[model samples]
Target: MKVSIITVVYNGAEHIRDCIESVLSQTYPDIEYIIIDGKSTDGTVAIVQAYGTKIARFVSEPDKGLYDAMNKGISMATGEVIGLLNADDFYRHDRVITNMVSLIEQTGSDAVYGDMLYVDRDDTQKLKRYWRSGWYSDNAFKWGWMPGHLSFFAKRTLYETCGLFRLDMKSAADYELLLRFIHKHKAKLSYMNEVTIVMRAGGISNSSLKNRLRANREDKLAWELNGLQPYFFTLWLKPLRKIRQYISKPPVKNAHS
Candidate 1:
């Protein structure tokens, strides 16, 4: 099945090349690489153009924000499955997508996700922490168990039915989207228990104390938006959920590498 990997960026010239290369070098040949850039002043657009025909669709223009850019990419995606790879993150290996697609087909899941590493920006291999996404459970959402956004992939039809990211949600649009998918629609999501992507630390949500607080507020808002329970209490769940990252170990070297 064809999978569309979308990368959303704004003035991300520094890491855009590596991100595009990671998608292009995937062993899965059926991937459609789509990029949505927010009219970067840097050379991000030029770097993407170097790939030219290899990119199924590339657009550079002003956007509302990250979620808006992602929404635009989703609108242009034609593949059966869709995934997001932020400009600062990259696939773990060339075979990562190949294996993820296989697992999705084998398990007959509507969505699938794997583990990921939080690595230093300059030292990709020196993982700062492991994001171990345990297997899915019906009650997992209540406890804030979500796969890393960078590693999650869902069927395009799912997006069509559930709707795209909410531009109003400044930081937690992804959290809200996951809640709708797993809780409201009850999508069959599978956890592969293997690393699928590597993300550099310092994303907008956690970039600063103020942003982190904003993320917490947005997450609480997500709980209410999806018609879930205890919206206010959900704020405490965030810190507890993050503790798993430092405590889990990586998968076997041969299996993951």
Candidate 2:
């Protein structure tokens, strides 16, 4: 099955090139690489254009925000399976997408996910945090457990049924979409207990205490909008779950250590 990878970026000159190269390097030859740029003024577009025909579609235009750009990419994706990779993230290896395809096909799963590593922005070789997403269960959502969206791949048709990201949600749209599809709709999903994406430390969701608080409110609203009720301590447990990530580091990637 063909896989479509979408990358939404804005002023990501520092990391966008590597992100593009990673998508192009996927061992799965039938990948349709789509890049959505919010009219980046920092020369991100030039680098994307440099890739030329290697990329399937490159959309450069003004957008409302991150989720809006994501929705646009989803609408344009033509491949059987669709996945998103941010500008500041990259596949753990060239075989990442190939592995994802094999797992999803083997299980006939509508969606599949894996783990991620958060590395130092200045040094990608140093793994700062490890996000190991265990197998999914409806009950886990109540406790605020979620798989890293970076490694989640879903069938394109599923989006039509579960719907796209909510524009009203500033920071929690991805969470809401996953909750809606997997928890509520019970989409067929499989988990690969391996790390496939490495994220650069720091992002809008966790950039500040204030921003995190705002995201919390959005998350709560996500439950409310779906007519679902979370455990009273659900939101509180979410951040607490991430505490271990700050202390537990992964094996260093540097050679000749």
Candidate 3:
């Protein structure tokens, strides 16, 4: 099946090449790579332009925000399945997409997600955290468990059915969307059991204590928006879950291995 990988970037010239190259290097033959840039003025557009048509769809324009650009990319995507890769992250290996497609076909699942690693921004080889996403359960969201968004891939029809990311949310939009799809809508999910993406450590939500608190508030709102109630400890457990990831180490063989 053809997969569409979307990368939304803004003023990310320093690492956009790595993100783009990772998609270009995928072992899977049928991939439609789409990049939505937020009118980057820092030469990010030039770097992506250097690749020419290798990138199937490139849009560089001012957007509302991160999730807005992502919504635009999703609208443009035309493939059996779609996945989002951030500008500061890259696929774990050339065959990550291959594995995702294989598992989706095998399990006949609406979505598939695997593990992820958090490495230093300057030195990706230096592992900082290992997010091993275990199997999904019916009450996973109630316990604040979620698969890595970067490693998650879902059928295009799922998006057509459930809807796209909310523009109002600042940080927890991804969590909200996943909660809606997997928990509320009951989308059939499959676990890939491997690291699918290597992400840079500094993310918006975790960059500051204030931002984290804001994200916590938004996370609570995520459940309320869906007309669902999270356990009292749910939002607390969400950030607390990452504490274990920081101490966890990657296995000998992962997607890159």
> How many residue pairs collide in each prediction?
0, 0, 0
Q: Estimate every model's Cα lDDT from 0 to 1.
A: 0.85, 0.88, 0.92
Off by over 4 Å in 3: 207-209, 255-257
Candidate 1: which pairs clash? Answer: none
lDDT per residue for candidate 1 within 1-257, as digits (tens), equals 99999999999998988899989998888999899999999888888998889999999999998999999999999999999999999877788888888889998999998888888999887778898887888867776677788789999999999999988787788889988898789998888777888888876646467867888788888878877775445566765788768777787544444
lDDT of 2 by residue, 90-110 (tens): 988788888888888899999
**Per-residue lDDT for 76-186 in model 3, tens only?**
999899999999999888899998898888889999999999999999889998999899999998998999888899999999999999998877899999999999999
Please, what is the TM-score per model? 0.93, 0.94, 0.96
109 in model 2: Cα distance from truth in Å?
0.6
Worst 10 residues of 3 by lDDT: 248-257
